[model samples]
Target: MPPAPQAYRPATALLDLGPTFWDPVEGANFPGTIVRYRNDRAAAEVGLADLDDAEWVRHFGRFAPLPDTLPQPLALRYHGHQFRSYNPDIGDGRGFTFAQLYDRAGRLMDLGTKGSGQTPYSRFGDGRLTLKGGVREILATEMLEALNVPTSRTLSLIETGEELVRGDEPSPTRSAVLVRLSHGHIRIGTFQRLAYEQDEDGMRALVGYVLRRLYGEESDDPIRLLDHVVRRTATLAARYMAAGFVHGVLNSDNINVTGESFDYGPWRFAPSWDPNFTAAYFDQTGLYAFGRQPEAIHWDVMQLAASLRLVAESEPLIETLQTFASHYQPAIADALLWRLGVVPRGAEPDRALVQTLERALRTTAAPLDRTFFDLFGGTVPASYDAAWDGLRAALADYRPRKPSDHPYWQGEPCAMLIDEVEAIWAPIADSDDWSRLHAKVDAIRQMGEALA
Candidate 1:
């Protein structure tokens, strides 16, 4: 009655997919391999950890039963606007959804595999994803999550023993498939597919189904459904700006209608707050740039609103669409303030605060001493006073007689304060002095346990 505690589907799905979605990619049938296996404890909090190798491969890869597990293949239908042009043929071309499970903390999660193998949707190209794609996605997830952005979590990457040919990068390089967990895989294009075809009955069925599954209500009403999607989308854009992330491809297919950040292809963080920064290799026009993400999100939302117009009034829908600005600014400001360790001024827009906020991105100019912003709680060396002071000096209005006396980190007894972060994400290679940094991470974990 309360949504089955996780990403559980009706038993009817078992009967629906049958044996098709259960077929695994034989050998290196996929350009990539499923090698490494890892779990995310933080992601597990959202009921994701349970979809381990055994449960995941069978469902996602469409492999036959090796043991007790759920049979849910990864296949969905959707259409999208590619480079400002509408394209009707697009879906899970080379990936599949394996299983939805409860993580360690009991949150609903979907485990899906990319570059797994060929699917019904594979058009003309080889049904595979490149190793570099996996690496880029891993970095995207790490950087965004560290900044507290809502995004899909990259769980594991496998380097297939075999080599696959690709156009870009190097030939016969390596091959890999990534296992990522997310809140939902459904997208706006999913509904638009049928809606645009003038299939009114089909659109009604799809919208109603999505509402019951994703929005937690059984509503045939299009207004509530559209508004719910708009609200979630507004928060998503706000979070993106807050974390300085750019989803290089904000096409309708890539924009998750459920509002969960999905599809990590060609995503990048602002190296230094350059608005035009793009992560995609072929983004010639910079449609999905860092500064344009909010606009891009709205554009995608409008498309969804347009599709929903088949059943809903345009007047009320326009108001819903207009509310994006009302919600995004405050949320983005809060995120910026938190990242800079500045106390929030509250719900009203803080013009002075906005100007001061620019200093955080300017790490070199004013040199806010002892700067720091970790998604996790502070504890690592980056969380130390040295990091803090480096950040404060960057602000415009500040009068500090001594370099170390900046207000941001110049409070109270110096020795009494403690900053603890569970893990530091720097490379373990040499410069990290891996052994030493590891010990620090362990010590922080131990300290956290003791405090708990």
Candidate 2:
């Protein structure tokens, strides 16, 4: 028989960072709790898969303190630039870090809640998440992960039985609380807060805490930390391009220090490789469009470097910031190769493949996911024409990582296009039918396995 699952290992790394980083808060007294979605796969990683539905809801929905974890939720503090406009009065307005524990890999993971309740940062708005919004987050994380993007995994989503009014969606829509499993919650905005206050001591303390606890690096040098963050952030931006994903909001607060992507809002997957495609309807300026994501991410990294100037010299930070493009260009080729399930020949050939394929995608306007799916292992079918000639030549010598015999590769690629997302939500909104949603998750998993 297989070995039994290990017990939950509670951690206090965040608490050890001191009270300056967060404020203790209570979760909202939700009128009713209905388990909408629970990720058993993610729970197993954190040793919570053994819990029954009631037990799960008690901890996740009711926000009960875990056996040896946090005593109460902590609302983290930070400031971010929204659409390039600096906003000093924003933090975990509608969410709070609920608990900390070690995953099976011994890495620290946070259980952060969304739509749980309000905090000091709520401002004049209600701190609640619409049910549809929660569902979208789940779908976004799931699809992104399948495409090999390092993202926060949705742990649990529970309907809170509260009707919320919003200008974005239909008024008086159902509300829910969502819990995400993430590597860490420290954001670029976290450092910006201390920098804005001109608190040198706080800046040094925060940098030390991140290095020792999250990164496992012994040095407290902020320059080293900035370099690590820039590298990871570059790789993340490349993965987003490879996945054809548009994270509508790329605010500093939304970008985590760990380089893991989280906080999904108004996100969309591309139907075709259109550089001008924007996810948010309000993004009239196309500031965070699909093609501009790398630039946006680079800007966020620069802000991070700027914050580090409190503890480090401006020269090294500038040098570190300049390395983003160098890391990003190569990372894009690697990420695309992973998605295409091909073996790399060399840097020159791989980059040529990426460049040629991009040109073909832009000119042909072929379906983004489908094009990658069809060309898996560099196999170009006879249906190709002159538009694909450049891409075919570039990929001629490459070989597939594995055989494309998976049943999923035989049919239409599993995609989360906007229309498909709405189609999945329509049933839940109209008749509470969730079969389609569950089926999509299952299909997405199959695709992930095939890619793996």
Candidate 3:
């Protein structure tokens, strides 16, 4: 086994950090399926293996001397408009980006905590994450990746020992820290919050800083800074659609300006081929539903553009916004072709193949796996085919009445039948059936490779 991380922060200080999200870690709890990890080993395995003394001290102010390296949410100072209102009170709550490290695959990743503790942004609420929230996030991320959506990965989930109250369901709930690894965690909401507060200079400096850090190619071009961000944001929104994942909470705060999938609360996999699946409990208007995802993305891009408009203009920003649909349509089309059994015959936009696939699915009311595997994925290579076959057989008697039931297939959103795909992902919520589901997942993966 690898050694634990030193209970100290690195001395090397990089970015000028800001306030915290919640007040403190009042409690903690997690599911048994969570993976326990030591960050020190993970860091050392990559080139960014060590932290300077100062770095550790500044980030991990309270939770020092940890058994393993947990990312200290580099307290980012950002403001956001929640539910269409400019709420200048937002930041990382529950937890923050504990650390940034390259993983075993040589991929750059951010170690993020779900309910590590509270920070400055925890205003009035307990900065605690629920047990179900953490579990759902893990399952959501895992399945999204298997479906080819760009997303954050769950690295470790440790129960911190405590409980708290909640208005949604029950009071005195379990608490835990769910650490997620992703490409980055910065968001457009981060910029909007600052700009909304007339922090023009702050927003500009942030834009320049982000370009250098992420979009390194456009760092020097001050005038085109917002333009670059707009393009990147637009591209990501389109891609999110290709994976059939609905980021229910597309609040300015949840929009990852870094292009990485940011927050994971209230997110739901689409139930069927429909794009109107809403994940949030009270999303009566379905602002962030399945059908509105693409449009929601543009609106978010517009918000980011508006934040930049502090230095630019609405018209120019709107012009830049046009690129979203262009990029998205083609990308989704290509993605759908791969998911469906047919290739782009260059005949009729492939709607026939899509319609056929959907019609067939509705006929048998089979699991998404069976529809895609038997039809699009085929029975070859065993894994994907077997997975679908297993899933269909297991859920042979199941039915879907709502849209948030299962992981939706991205291509041709409305062309298939959906009982809310709940049954396909049923195992994730139930530990008893996880083993069977995992085996099926492995098979699904094989089929995914063929599609790729």
Candidate 4:
């Protein structure tokens, strides 16, 4: 049967907050290009599935504001700590929030861009993105979503006919503009900027705006907001660990207020259960390694607490900050159980199970993701091995989330390992063959549905 048409409900709540938070900006003009990809599933959620290719490129590619959306794009102002060093010079240098709208679930979503153009924050660099960068982001978000991590969605990728010079990759690389749909673009760095400026009035206004827009609460007290953000951040960190993802950069600005992980750059899934596993080639100290993500997020939370001091008491803020450790441990267990497709027994038992699994994976140097797939949704060859007896015994108390008759249980587990991702991109880099990338995305979506 054909489904009922979705209703269009575009919104612009963020723009209503006032011009103090952002600067009006224009997107760059690119040479005539074509839409490389479009997330129709996500588009349907936002009542935009009927848009033709021309409309898609006109709005997303050409950066024309959507009907009933924001009148203009906004370059949000923010500051972030880079590598533990305070940097006041950072903002949305290359991208801006193009529009805001409500999805089918009534959640306020931001239509933000990457490589859209230069803004006030574009400091001595071209506001551009490479086609390879857009491709990598698409892969990263897809894999993370399939693994049940709270993340942004890559909505569109349009290949702009421009050559960009980059030091890290092949110079004069093909250019593209990417758009990301997310819960919100407000970051921990957003508050940091307010605090740095000593703008108590601005801080108070931001606190009120965030509470009303994102949290759906009207609270004059900032402590409650801090507590909520800390809990969300801890849960996000736990999800990353369960997914074996290293974010590479744990800067305050990169951490969103909604606790939804976005702005993927140099992200990698760990091949094995190594806490010290790093993703970025430039991360010499491994400060934002796979294992240290929780710590880095906690540090970012403390910074948020510090920023809230302008409106809230430090005593309560500090107390809220202290709960992150307690929140994270149980969150890790729950996340792990979710990935394993099992109902958790309880807090203590779940923690013990997680510890047991981690110990087994580390001691045997097992492939992290493959190990989860091996034990979950039924059993693979690893289940019968004596080495996994502890995990088997632990699983005796839990039940499968999926039915035993599910077809996914009968096949090999799908994975998005580094080697596999590069292999998918290799054909495109060499011969413009995108069939592998499309196939991989389809397989990842299937995995997500099976796990669901």
Candidate 5:
């Protein structure tokens, strides 16, 4: 059955937190342009399904704050460690939190923008996003969500009729504005900034606000908060591995407090189970590679632990940090079972199964997505390939999520490889053709539904 239409319930909880956390700013005025894409599925969750192209342009492209929402947009302030070096001079330079609202599930959601406009934090640069960058983000979020990775959703993308020069891509690319729907915009860097300023009181208030809004826990203890973040971060790392995704940039600022992954810059999915695979062109040392993601996330969590020292005891925080491996290993096993679409056996047997699957993948170097499709949903094997013998034995004691006749199981696996994503955007880049992009999104949505 179709889900009931959701009603928009605007709120201003973040605004109520006061001015120290962010700076009030207005969105940039773009030349009158058209709405290029609207995520109606995501829109429905926030009661925005009926928005016309003009309305989308006004709200997203023109930076008009939603009525009855926050009175003004806020460019958040944060400090992050970029490539293991503490960079205290960073914040929301281009985008801001436009509004907040409750979704149909009663969870608080934030409507944040990217490439919205320049703010006080915009240091010596034009605040605009390339049209191609916007397109890539939409694809990244949609595909990640379909794979059941905890991620932010792309709400809207609008072309803003401006030419911007960039060093990474071709010069003078078209400009755009992107709106993202996320659980919250708070980041680990948010706390790090407070620590850097020696604002112990500010850190306490921010922690309280996060607990109330996100975790719904009544405890104000910093150790409790650290424990929660560690668990969530472990699960997030495992999910990325299970989905074969590389976030490219795992900086503290990019890691949200909610443990949901967002801000897709140079993201990619693994073509095969290569642990050293990297997505970003400029990651010279491969700091955020496929295999090192868990380590990177753990390091970021330790930074969070370090920041919390201003308000909490260091001993408790360090003890909590040590629990990461215990949380991460089990989470990875569970996520792998989820990807394989099988019910888990006993704990011992499940762990052994996970280990066997890992060893097989590493030995064969099989394409991760193809391997899932080959084994999941009760699809019969065409031959008794010796390479898959361990995997077949691993599945012997588990049941599939669907019958062998499920339609999605009958065809080739749907993969969002980087090459395919570029092909989807090539037509649009050349002649403004968006049919392929639209079709790809539809295919991804269908796969998500089938998995559910």
Candidate 6:
């Protein structure tokens, strides 16, 4: 008998890069397999929308390899700096890349897991994800995508019947395993690992692989790769700021070559334009605060440049690192304009509008998300105070891109503040009611359509 034809095309591209980049491993046998969430929209993009609930759990929960994708999962190896301290002992501690395939657009995508089980990199810690943690990631990625931020889609989240002890949250929480749809699993830490070993050949091979596979280019020049990554990271940081988001941990390992945001942990959305607001409770120093995201990302890019120096020249990499500011400033302006539903004017005028808006936000007590909602489409409300004068002037000649007639525009703007997040979780924790979570996702999707 022959195997049945699958709907999606599978590829073993990562295996082609050879065994140095990753180690093959097996997934855990969970006691329970209950599908908590399924991303049908993202599934449609990958031709998996036809999968029934049973099939979804069989593939995602049991970690079964899709048809011809991967015979076994791969635990990727990498190292990164955590809180400015170098640590070479870190890698995929709780997850592995399960499968790879081309999306409908013919773009290569990876099905990576979180809390799927232990690996060589577990480092004396249990490889488990809290159910609450998985819920937070789902909310973060959905809200970010609705805000037009480039992020890895949360494909599936399945609750595993287990009790887990942890120090961060209340101990003995429920466990879960998450599947993420991402462009690639290769991180800056991937390059750093090669550089730390003084394996110049490995670094060279990795650069070629990244360019050929993820970037769709044919260049081995490490400097060129660094430049591309710097620009993309800059734009990513700017979008984070414009969206009033604080990615609590800006570790190099958390950032990937594709510049898409993934691996959510202790992330938060800013209520107002406060620079000192931090996300992670342990980040008492505010190193990755709401305002310092650009600086943190710039420092990460510098680390990448230093890693690339193992194979490339010094001056060009240094020069490429310096371009972060040039890319970031314009990107934030454009991102803010897009959120406000206004068309772009020239660079200088758009910048002025952003600066004025920031200044106004600082002087008032209004939440940043609400401020954006009120002044959407360049309309300065008559109810606004004198603090909005500068912003009103800045937007005087600008016209809105579209009328604020989307049904969502009439009511309050959707906000993922901590209080709201907790409110949504309370029902599920108490009685397994998921109505609020479902409703929130629907509202965020509507907002995305309106913004588009």
Q: Which has the greatest TM-score?
A: 2
Candidate 5: which stretches are off by over 4 Å? 378-384
lDDT of 2 by residue, 32-136 (tens): 999999999888888898999999999999999988888889999999889999999999999999888888777789999999888988998688899999999
Candidate 1, after superposition: displacement of residue 16 in Å?
Answer: 8.8
lDDT for residue 173 in candidate 4, whole number 0-100: 83
Clashing pairs in 5: none
- Lowest summed-lDDT stretch of 10 residues in model 2? 1-10
Model 5, 247-296: lDDT tens digits are 99999999998899999889999988888999999998999999999999
TM-score of each: 0.73, 0.98, 0.70, 0.97, 0.97, 0.97
| TM-score, cand. 6 vs. native | 0.97
| Residue 66 shift from truth in candidate 5, angstroms | 1.3
Segments in model 2 whose C-alpha atoms lie over 4 Å from true places: 1-6
Question: Arrange candidates by lDDT, highest first: which order?
Answer: 2, 6, 5, 4, 1, 3
Candidate 4's TM-score reads 0.97
lDDT of 2: 0.91
Of the pair 2 and 6, which is ahead by lDDT?
2
Best model number under lDDT: 2
Report RMSD (Å) for each prediction in the order shown.
8.3, 1.3, 9.4, 1.5, 1.3, 3.2
The Cα error of candidate 3 at residue 153, in Å, is: 1.1
- Candidate 6 per-residue lDDT, tens place, 1-452, comes to 42333358788889877888898988899999999999988887777888999999999999777888888999999999899998999989999998998887777899999999999999997888999999999999999999989899999999999999999878788999999999999999999999999998889899998888888888988988997898889889999998899989999998888899999999999999899999999999999999999999889889999999899889999999999999999999999999888999999999888888888887785798888898889988999888888888888889899988999998888999999999998898889998999999999998887887
If both were scored by TM-score, which would come out higher, candidate 3 or candidate 6?
Answer: 6
Model 4 regions lying over 4 Å from their true place: 1-5, 378-384
lDDT of 3 by residue, 86-165 (tens): 77767876666655554454344555567766667777866777665665565566556666566676654444446767
| Pairwise TM-score winner, candidates 3 and 5 | 5
